[model samples]
Target chain A: MRNLLKILYTYHFLLMFIALEVISIIMLVQNNRYHSASYAVKAKAVSGSIYSTVSDFKEYLSLKEANKALAHENAILRNYLKSNYGTFDTTKISVNDSIYKQHYRFQDAKVVNNTVNKQYNYITLNKGTKHGIKPDMAVIGPQGIVGLINGVSENFSNVLPLLNVDFRVSARLKKNNYLGSVTWEGKDFEYCTLKDIPQHVQVNKGDTVITTGYTGSFPEGIMIGTVSSSKLKDGNFLSIEVKISTVFKTLSYVSVIEDLTKEEVTKLKTETEK
Target chain B: MIGEYIKIALRFFFLVVLQLLVLNNVQWSGYLNPYLYVLFILLLPFETPNWLLIILSFLLGFTIDSFSNTWGMHSAACVLTGFIRPYFLKIISPRDGYDSATRPIIRDFGLEWVIKYSLILIFIHHFALFYIEVFKFSLFFHTFLRVVLSTLFTFTLVIISHFIIYKR
Candidate 1:
């Protein structure tokens, strides 16, 4: 055994490379099983602690802005209640118009350590297992979708930001319903590209882009961005350039949207991937 | 002596954090993500053991892996780099070489040797990393493109970092 090992080592780095290949194969095979079980254990404790700490950090930073946003949102809700008061015919005449029917959950979170400059930028959030955050959960800001959670750390999770080249969010024109894939070119934080839209879709320079409701993260009709420009790709498909509204680098606060059906949908998707 | 070892360890920790937290995040094009923190290993004292060097490289890469969630890429690259460092030292060995006392630097290894040394190591590290991250060889075009682009970016950044940190 010693002599055989020596002979292999005499092949110098070739032996090392072969060893690595074997390890890589083994890891690929065992990754899913290992990640699920171990993630359950480790993610709960570590991610939870990190999430709380980072949440504390973020609440401080967003105190003023968050208060303003809340006040504005409150004002809008109150005004909405006033306008539709006649629609309610209850004995008490309560002002309730579709408030209970809103389909979006706004779970506040903190960005722990986010990167917008990477071709594969990932943002770590302070909401995870404890906060009901899960992988593939839709993350958004006041502007639009920040990205989806790729890995969860129990109380904390990492988001694959739209600034990352890996992100491909399905979006459509609000007025016309022309759908396309929105992806970051891994360059500018202020811009992204929307591709595969038919050139005949009649795109305007400032038409609203919103989620198409094809995936689990965001509901259909959630705002993504406005069309910055449009061009003919291969002189057929419409290639629209979009300017993302979120400031990922300077971003501090976010909302992790936990769709009620996310768990079942993700479980099915994960099984399919395996 | 204990204090010195602790300081060295702390510096290694600092380099890795800065690499992932700051430098890895700074992407100009989708093409470039520089790995300059490995310079800590490159600049180590010449008497460092071969086995320890390999282990250090593995640890360095593993840390990066844990953060990025990409399996063994950084480890493979760092290990390959560690394996090649000694050979590089031999290739550029001078009559009164700095292998025993002097460190690998522009001042010690001279301008030409330093450039040659850094370029070779950067290519080796980036090749292993990009190729490993690109597990499926089926995507030949994409893997090839990344290898070329990342190597160029890594080479430029590593050289610039060396000049700034260890200027002759």
Candidate 2:
């Protein structure tokens, strides 16, 4: 017992180092796998509130720009109103409207904090469970797609933005409907990469890319970015660089998309799988 | 001695605030994100207890991680740096050896010695941070570039700030 005590005393620092590193690595692995699980939510709560206060000050500085974005979005929404589009198929007897109802809902939120320089970039929003924000909801700026909500607190939420290496959005070419995955390469905030695109499809510079709606987190036709360049890689697929539309530097306002039919869809999917 | 501990404690809060509020928001680029908080770990008194050094380093990193939402990446790297710091001190010690009363600042140790000491640990800290952040060897070259670029940027900042902030 005395010899074991002597050994323990001699290597105490090494043991402490190992213990601390083990705890840190465990936290990293846990947070990375289940971003919304564990103390991440608690950490977000404390940091989120602090960032909310700081961004509140920042938000005041950009009031004019925020107003301009709101005005622009209002004009776009006004153009899509029923009055502007006219009555839909007035000649037909419309019935069973439940089958064709909208499956997505939007809640406006303010971005409290955002980081584009990190490998795993995250955005903190001022909305949370109290504001009907939840994990897996899609976030979008007025100009383009922002990210998906990763965690939520009482009054704040975190988003896994497109700038993160782990973030992958299903996107398709607007012209040919060829599907590919969009993800950040951890280099530049203004650009991301589109993978899994076959070389046979001719892709041009400035080709529009939009969400595929396969995941249902985001609806179809929402803009993601444009192809900045493309080249055939390994003689099998196209390695394409896309210029993301949302200027992350100036992003402030966003809309969180809540899928109303998510529970039903997931339930049906699980049932079919079983 | 108590007064010295109080001063170190105050410096801790000051560095944490500066790191999270100003340095973290810079977003200069992926390659140039200078991690100035590690300066706190780098400048602890030469006579600081090994256990205290490890704990303080972990706390410094944990505080920064909390603010930045990095989920313990900084803490892990900081602990590693602290663990290896004693070996670094032994290597850079003068021929006559260090005075327990004196702190390890550039003013006391001279520019050359401090430069070598800071550069080695900063490189290790950044290398571990970037590699752990990616957790993959597939992008080894890119991660290494980030490690070197960030180390250079952070080392330059540490040197400049040492002269400017600690020239007294």
Candidate 3:
């Protein structure tokens, strides 16, 4: 025992170093796998709120450019509303059911930490608990749906940005409504992969992709990317290549979609699992 | 001595603040971010023990991680640098060794050795940082390119800052 103690003390630093590194690796894997599963709704809201504030602070310097972006988005949203729901009474908000149908509200955030070059890209935000932001809220930008909120603190939050290898967004063809998983390849900032797409779907370069509305985090029709290239995988699946339109290295603003019906949906999911 | 202590402490806080607040946001390329803050770790008193140095590195990295929203990139790099520092010092020891050396000034070791020592550790630290950050070895070519580019940038920054401040 004395000999063992002597050896341990002699290499105590190495042992501690190894132990901490192992713990760090474990934490990294666990955080990646179970961020949403473990923390779920409440934690994400806090993170979303943090990023929102951070983005606001960062955008203060680029107010003119941001105003232009806001103006452009406003014009697009107005045109969309005019074409889709012209003269409809939006104030006649339905109590229970319509909330689920449009269960989300969008708020803007900025990238405090963004890395397109990494296998796992994370973005930190400056908004937090005071902002009413929560976990599992879908984050979006002018180009398309960004990613999900992951970590949160009292004053800040981290996003598992779409550029991460671990991210697999459920995307579909805007032209024909075919669905697949859109993932990153960790090489470039502007590109991603659309896998599990069945062959014979008539895919081509420049075909638009959008979200499938299956995850209530985002409403249907949020733009994902355009199919920049594609190849046949085996005989049935299409290995479609997508180029995301969001400019992340210079990304300044994002909107966090607050899901109103998240609790009920989560409760239903838990009950079904049980 | 008291004044010197005050100076180091203030510089430490300032460098950390600059690292988290300003340098963290500067995305020069997909592969590069400048870190002049590790100069602090590199410039610490030569006789500080292994455990304390490692712990300090861990703290510095952890604080940076908190600000930048990472798990352990900087912390891991800093600890790695601390661990290897003693061996590097031993290899580069002068005729008289560490006792007579009062500072890590360039004049003491000449510009070439100083630059070489700093670059070696900086390369190890930053390479480990980016490699672990990308988290897999699959994109070997791409990651290697980034490591080289970022190391050059960081080394330039370190050398420039030291020349200006320490005046050796």
Candidate 4:
């Protein structure tokens, strides 16, 4: 027993190294699962505040660009207003119309921190649980879809952006409605891969791709990207390259979408699975 | 002795800030990520206790991970670098051994010695970091390419930083 103690004393430095490495590996594995709430909450709060401060300074440099984008969005929204069109019929629709129940609500948030080069990139937003942001909600930029909220704290949240290799979303070609899955290849921030579409489908360059809404995370028909190119893969499916619509580097303001019927859908799905 | 400790503490804070605020935002390409934070571990006093070195490296890495959301990749790499530092120092020591009063900086050690010392440790750190990041061997070649490119980039930045920080 004394000899064993001597051995341990001699190799204490190596033992300590191994112990620390083991702890780090455990944290890494746990972090990949994307469900470590305590760490996420604490880390997000600290990093989020620092990033928000830096972003506050950066906000000035990009004010002109942000104003331009907001102005464009305002113009598009104005065209959808009720006052834009003259009423031809006298019949008035009731406020609680059965055909038009609200299915989704959007909350505006500014991006405080973002990274596009990593294999599992995450974006931090200024709004969080206080603003009703929750896990699994869809985040969309002005140009197109952004990502999904994977972690949330009191006043900040983390987004698993489209650039992450682990991020997958259901997308369909607008021309033929052919469905496929969109995934990042961990190479270019501007491009992602769309798979599972059969080679027989007619795929043309610049064909629009949008969300399928089959998962209920995103509403149907939200723009994802446009097909850049397509190639035959394994003689069965076509591996198509998509140019993502939202330029993540310049991404500033985004809207987090909350689906009101999501709980019901999830309940039904769980029951059906059983 | 207390002044030396204070200097080390100030350097730790300074390097972390430089890494998070400036270097982290500078994404030249998908392949080049210059992690200058490891310089903190590289510049520690030669006589720093082995256990303390490991712990400090782990803390530095964890702090960066918390901000970047990399979890433990940086921590693991930093710990390994710290573990191997003493051995590397022994291998590349001067004829009369290191002066007790001197720290591991380019001004104290010649340019070639400093470069050689940092090259091996930085390569190991970047290799472990990028590989642990992907956490798979399927992209072995791709990750290796990234490690090599990033190591070169980081080495250049570290050398430039030495001249800037330890100006003659």
Candidate 5:
């Protein structure tokens, strides 16, 4: 026992080093796999407030650009208004519309923090649980899909952006309805790779890709990006490169999508799997 | 002694703020992430106890991790850096050995010694950091490129900061 105590005293520095590293690694694994809501919640409140204050100053610098993007979106929305189009058939036909209920609700939020360079990137928004934002909700920019909420605090939330390596979403080609999965290769911010599309399916440059709604986080038909190129891989699957539509660097504002039927869909899915 | 401690504490605060507010936001390119916060660990007094060094390094890394949402990558790397730092210092000591009361700074040691010291430590820190971040061996060459590029970027910043801070 005396010899053992002597040995520990001599190697105490190394033991302390190992202990600290082990703790850090444990935190890393927990943060990555389970998203460690308890720890992140407190950290988010402190960091989120700092980022929001800094972003408030930055918001003014990008006001001109934000105004232009908002104006363009407003014009597009105006074109869809019922007053702009006339009905060719005036006959009143009452269809069974009660079956169609709202499946998604949107809340506008300002991006207080965003990073695209890292292998695993995250975005922070000004709105959080206080504003009804929750984990697993989808976030979309003016042009296309952004990401999904992974962590939330009282007045802030973190988004696992599509640029991250772990982010994968079900998407389909708009031209032929062929399904594939979109994943970032950690190479470029403006592009992601689409895999699992069979080689037999026709693909071409500039073909549009949209969400398939299979994940239930995002609704159907939201734009992801257009195919920049496609190649045959291993004689079975076509590895296609897609140029993402949303400009992540200049992202200022976004909409958080709350899928109202998510609980019902998830419950049904679990039952089916079981 | 108290004054020296106060200075170290101030440097810790300054470096953290600079890292989170300025360096973290600097989008030079996807590959050039210069982590200037490690400078805090690099510039510590040689007389600092080993256990205190490791704990301070962990705290510095954990603070950065909390703000950046990187969790534990930085803390792990910083602890390793701190663990190996004394050995590295011993290896690179001058023919006569280090002065008793001198801190590791550009003013105390010449530019060449400081560069040689920081370059090796920074490379190791970036190497450990990027690999822990990717956490895979498949993209070996890709992560290697990032490590090299980031080390060079960080080295240049450290040298520039030395001149900026120590200029009389």
Candidate 6:
């Protein structure tokens, strides 16, 4: 017993090191699972509130730029307002008013904390569960699609932005409607790679890419990026590169899109698969 | 001794806030994310207990992770650095060894020794961090570029901060 204790004492530092490393690795594995580490994310109470306060001050510094973006979005929205589409002639073929239901809602939120340089980037917003924010809601900037909500707490929410390696968006060519997935290479914030595109599709430089509603997360036609380069790789696929539209560095204001029919659609799809 | 401990504690808070608020937002070219908070771990007293060093490094990294939303990546890399630090010191120890009160700062250790020591630790830390972050050997070359560039960037910051905080 005395000799065993002596051995343990001599190697205690190494043991401690291994123990700490194991704990950290366990946390890392837990965090990589989407639902498991949701509560431990930055959107929790004290840390979330503190980051919100700090980012609030930083947000004020860019109020001018944010205001301009907001005005531009408002102008674009005004052009598509139901009122601007002109009154439909209801007298002919008395249409059922209840047949048309809104399936998407937008809520405004301020970015409280953001990081683009990390391999797994996450954005923290000033709105959360208390403000009706929820996980899986699609987040969009004024100019383009931003990210998907990962977790939400009382007053803050975390977004897995496109700059992250783990983030992927289903996108389609604006001109040809060819479907592909856009993923970051963890190298550049402004660029992401579009994969699974067949080489037969004549993809051109400067072609636009937009989100496809097939994922049910984002509305179809929301701008994603522009094809910067496309080259044939392995003779079977076109290794396409895209220049992401949203300026992530200056990103401040965003709107969380709540898909009202998501639950229904998901349920129906699962049942159909079964 | 108490005064030195208190000072380290204050520096810890300051470094965390600076990293979370200022450096986190500063991105020039996407690959140049200078992690200045690691300086806190590097600046710990020469004779700090191995257990205490590991704990302190973990706490510092965990705090940064909380703000950055990278739960365990930073802490894991930090613990690795702390675990290797004693061996690192043993390998590079001076002929007479070190004093408990002296730090690894440039002013006391001379520019050459400090640079060698800082580069070694910074390279190890950044390599561990970037590789674990990507977690894929397929992009080994890409991750290597990040490690190299970030090491240089962070090392530059470490040198500049040494001059700023410890000028005669």
Winner on TM-score between 1 and 6 is: 6
Q: Rate the local accuracy (lDDT) of all candidates.
A: 0.70, 0.86, 0.74, 0.89, 0.91, 0.85
Q: What's the lDDT for residue A143 in model 2?
A: 90
B-chain TM-score of model 1 = 0.86
- Greater lDDT among 3 and 6 belongs to 6
For candidate 6 chain A, which ten residues in a row score worst on lDDT? A34-43
Candidate 5 residue A141 Cα shift, in angstroms, is 0.3
User: Can you tell me the CAPRI class of model 5?
Assistant: high
The alpha-carbon RMSD over the true interface for every model, in angstroms, is 4.9, 1.3, 3.3, 1.0, 0.9, 1.6
Poorest lDDT segment (10 consecutive residues) of candidate 3 chain B = B63-72
Docking class of 4: medium
Model 2, A147-235: lDDT tens digits are 98888889988888898887888999999999999888877889999988999999999999999887548988889999999988887
Model 6 per-residue lDDT tens digits across residues A109-195: 988778787778888788988889888889999989899988888788888888887788899999988888988888778999998
Candidate 3, residues A1-274: lDDT per residue as tens digits? 9999999999978886776566556545555552743332244354345445555677787788768877998988888663576454656545434546765777776565566655666776665556766766788888787888766666656677788877777888988888888888887888888898888789888999998877648778988888898899888899988889787766667888887777898899999999
Better of 4 and 6 by TM-score: 4
DockQ of 3: 0.39
TM-score of each: 0.73, 0.92, 0.84, 0.94, 0.95, 0.92
Determine which window of 10 residues in candidate 2 chain B has minimal summed lDDT.
B22-31
Instruction: Grade the docking of candidate 6.
Output: medium
Q: Tell me the tens digit of each residue's lDDT in model 2 across B8-76.
A: 899899988888777887756666788988888888988888998999988888888877878779989
Q: Where does the lowest 10-residue lDDT sum fall in candidate 6 chain B?
A: B62-71
Model 3 lDDT tens row, B71-102: 66677778888788888899987878877446
Report lDDT (Cα) of residue B93, candidate 2. 85
Q: After aligning candidate 2 to the native by TM-score, how far in Å is the CA of A83 from where it should be?
A: 4.6
On DockQ, the stronger of 3 and 5 is 5
lDDT of 3: 0.74
- Going through the candidates in the order shown, the clash numbers are 4, 0, 16, 0, 0, 0
**Which has the greatest lDDT?**
5
